[model samples]
Target: MISFINVDCTFGKKAGIKNVNFTINSGDFVFLTGPSGAGKSTILRLIYMDLFPEKGKVSIRNFDSSTIRNHEIPFLRRRVGMIFQDFNLLQDRDVYENVALSLYVSHYKTREIKNRVYEVLNQVGLGHRVHFYPSELSGGEQQRVAVARAIVKEPVVLLADEPTGNLDPRVSLELINLLNKINQRGTAIIVATHNYALIPRIPNARLFQMEEGEVTKIT
Candidate 1:
């Protein structure tokens, strides 16, 4: 459902990618593995349209980076979920409210929003943490909150940018397993991580090993 055709995007002093080409079908589990400045996160940003390619194009189902308008980006984002190394939860908002905000922005009804927020929180094993705030939860629990927030929209593809960067190994594995379960349910997953150790934990996942600013290997 996603395709990157000879995509080349450059920005800042170190954040960029070059000639990156790949296709991720629905329900596929893919990993972008490389060093600190390997451009993994840039790829994810391109997928969600937070970054645009200067050369070639990124195509995600209906949206194309080269031709997409400003107004259409929001619709593309609703179909693409994102998680980050830092759990980006609002300290002022409780877990339930944080998860509900996306649906609220999408104009889902109050009842539907409540039901979906609860459903995805439960799916991420955080059902009881609904009333908890970001500071009250552990690092792992907070990340689970982020996961819940991302999936509440039932996105077509989920992009995780070093999602386990702050968690311990065990909690990281648990998070990966949770993501695996979500993928099995038919949402494609693309994780941008530097941890090569995580690759073995995921079965049958495609590996896109990047170097400098290019995809040097895919296994």
Candidate 2:
């Protein structure tokens, strides 16, 4: 569902990513692994259109980056879910409201929005925390809320950047399992992380290695 063809991204005449090419099919769970400064986050940014390549092309569900218009970004983003390590939730909003915000902005009917919110909240094991604010929950619980928010819209692809970065190993494993379950339900998942221990647990996952701005399928 996603492809990068000889893509190159440069910032201030310096290379950010070089000749990176890869394809992720629907229903696949992939891991993007590399050391610090290896362009892993750059790849995710490219996929999310936060940064466009200077050369070559990025295609998502057959929509080429060059051909995509600015007005189409909101629509495109709605089709892809992103989970960040920092748990980017609004502290003032309750968990349900945070997840519901996406659907509301997309103009989903109020009844449908509530149903979607409840479904994903239950999926993330955060249904009981629906009325809790981000600051009121534990780190793991907050991340769960973030996950619910990401999937509430039922995005076709899920891009996660260091999703377990701040969590303990046990919680990290739980999060990985949650992601696996989501992928099993057919949402393509790409997790950018340096945690190799999680890979052994996910036997069927594909691994992508990045170094010096180049990415390759190493496993």
Candidate 3:
């Protein structure tokens, strides 16, 4: 449901993606693997329209980066979820509040928001920590909160950049397994990371390797 056609986006003299082309179908699980500056994160940004292509275009369903207006970006975002290496949970807010904030912004009813937040937190294995602050959770638990926050809105596609970068290997594997489960339930997932070792853990996932901002292989 997402396509990047001959896309070229550059941020500076030596940083950005070039001639990147790919398609992610619905319910698909894909991995973007390469070293730093290989344009993995750039590809995710393009999908979410955080960075418009300098040439070519990015299309996610009906929304096209080439023609989408700024006001419509928020609507687009509601269908796409994103997580990062660093858990971006609100330090002062409890887990329940963090996940519910998205629904609140979208003006969901209070009862519906409560149900959705509880369901997602449980999906991420954090139902018991609903009232705990970010500081009270472990690294993995905090990242689970981040995942819950991202998926609470039931996004169509989830974009995760270096999601396992901050966790230990065991915790990273657990996180990957959790994401795989989410993918199985129909939401397409695209993860960008440099961890080749983790790729094997995700069976049937398509792998796209990059080098110097260009895709080098698809396996």
Error of 3 at 65 (Å): 0.6
Pairs in clash, predicted candidate 3: none
Query: Tens-digit lDDT track for model 2 on 34-65?
Result: 88878888988888888898999998995678
Count of backbone clashes for each model? 0, 0, 0
Error of 2 at 172 (Å): 0.3
Least accurate stretch of 10 residues (summed lDDT) in model 1?
11-20
Residue 187 in model 3: lDDT: 94
Candidate 1 residue pairs that clash: none
lDDT of 1 at 217: 89
- At residue 52, candidate 2 shows an lDDT of 90
lDDT by candidate, in order shown: 0.92, 0.89, 0.92
RMSD of each: 1.2, 0.9, 0.8
TM-score of each: 0.97, 0.98, 0.98
